[model samples]
Target: MEDIPNYVAATFIAIVIAVLGFIYYAVNTATPGKKNLTSSLVVTILVGWIFFVCVQTFNGYFTNLSGIPRLPMFVGLTIVSIIILFIWPRTRAILMEMPITTLHYIHIVRVPVEMVLWWLAVSRAIPMDMTFEGSNLDIISGISAPFAAVFMVGSRSKSRIGATIWNLIALALLYNIVKTAIGYMPYYFTPTGGEVANLGVFYFPYVLLPTFIVPAVLFSHLVSLYQLIFKKDQPQF
Candidate 1:
């Protein structure tokens, strides 16, 4: 962890903040009458989650090899929570109200995130398998996000087929990286020679990758898919 450069951490922090800021903006613009209430609720939940993860990370809760692996548990709970939120009527409505373009644009953050992972791998803070140099090719989703948003989601676009295909492909890419990361967890798989522990994500700032960033990106993809498949009246732009 100490071997990783400070700028890497700084860049990751900036990415997280940018993601949160865009989320707040999306909520505010989507919810007209209850924008304030909805935005506040969203911000509070995200910030609270970040703080909780920070406390646990600092206390070495996730790094503990005893009893059960807390990092996986934390990830499972966060994913379940996102599922529940999407299932709940009010929350679902708020998320569904957010523009498809906004959801698509949110994925641009993944580019910088992938870069940070590569940096961490270079510093031996995490296994190289988690980066583009290895098995993780999730950066493709980030690089193509803007083009998909503009071309496939334009106001005069005829069909949602293109956007739907892009969403599914991007979602698959997300799943690939996530599975790779979890597979390399110390409790699950031991690293061999010349490889480093995947402990970077269990530390400060990087902890947000699993707790906040992944969840946010996952949620956006899910919402976009739902909108594309079910929402017939959704505007192209």
Candidate 2:
């Protein structure tokens, strides 16, 4: 096995920190009083990520480990993110209050994220199926986000219908990539057996995908949907 380089890991770690920092800034706008909790959330997520890296890479628990239906770490992180966005009272409220336009901008992270995945694929760290050329069409969502943010969100045009449709489409794209990723894992329930094992995801930086970015991006899509549907604050140009 090729030893992972420090620069690759360091660059990804920096991206993760930047993404979380942006999230904190965006979220703080809505829940000013939750500063302590927000800070704690950042700390907790970083700590959790460090622990996951240590376990999977340093401790060697996930090296060639197989037979599990799903990576428990991935599933656990996704589940916790769902609960935080949908079930937690204060957190849910803050998410709901977030400006729909900002939600659209947040998804721009997916663009760089997709590029990073492609780089990993080029390095043979992950499968090509997870990249733009394959089944993962999630980059479409990222590319279209800014346009949607401008036309649908900023203008507050009479295009609520268009906005709603865009969100649904982006959400579906996200779901597709997530489903494909899970199915390609090295597990008993995996849909296929091939040379490509999703071993890259278990390492540092990439682990942040399941732990931080995907969940956060997923939550962003969900909350945007909630705001579009439940709340009637659609801005009009």
Candidate 3:
């Protein structure tokens, strides 16, 4: 981790902020009447989660490979929270009504995220497989996000189907990188790169990837999918 340049970490932190800002914007836009309450709630919850994860990481909770793995547990809680938000009527409505452009454009952050991953890989903080040079093809999704937003910006049936397909493909890419990351954790699986154990993620800044960035990206896809498949009329840009 020490070998990683300061710029990489700075870039990553910027990405995290960008993601959080986008989420706040999306929530605020979706629920205009309750924008203040909902936006504040979203920011508070996300900021609190990030702080908690940082404290845990500083305490060596996630780094301690001895007992049950804390990293997976932490990620599981996030997943469950997302599921609840999707199923809860009020929150679900916000998600369903969020602008499709918001969902699509937010993914642009993934481009810099992938670059940060590549930098980490170069520093040997993580395995190469987690970057574009290896198995993680998620950068493609980031690159195409703007075009996807423009291409699907109407109520056309074909556009909706096309957008749905793009979302699924992007979701699968996300899953692939996440799975690859888990396989390199020191809890159960052996490190993919002999000595590198994907431990950077258990540290500050990087911890934000699992707790905030990934979840935000995942939720965006889910919201977009729900809007495309279930909502009768798609929101225009």
Residue-level lDDT of model 1, residues 28-98, one tens digit each, is 87798983888888899889999999998999998888888888888889899989978899888877778
Off by over 4 Å in 2: 1-7, 33-57, 64-70, 155-158, 188-194, 234-237
Candidate 1 residues lying further than 4 Å off, grouped into runs, are 156-158, 235-237
Candidate with best lDDT: 1
Better candidate number, 1 or 3, judged by TM-score: 1
Instruction: Kindly state the number of residue pairs that clash in model 2.
Output: 1
Cα lDDT for residue 194, candidate 3: 61
Give the best candidate by TM-score.
Answer: 1
Candidate 3 colliding pairs:
none
Candidate ranking (TM-score, best to worst)? 1, 3, 2
What is the per-residue lDDT of model 2 for residues 1-237, given as tens digits with 9 covering 90 to 100?
266555666667776776676566666676677756775675576567657655665565655465553355655766676776688776677777776787888887788788777877777777898999889999998899899999887764546778889989998998898887776666633334655766687766576677677777877778877877777754462
Worst 10 residues of 3 by lDDT: 152-161
Estimate every model's Cα lDDT from 0 to 1. 0.88, 0.73, 0.86
Of the candidates numbered 1 and 2, which has the greater lDDT value?
Answer: 1
lDDT of 3 by residue, 178-204 (tens): 999998887756753366768778887
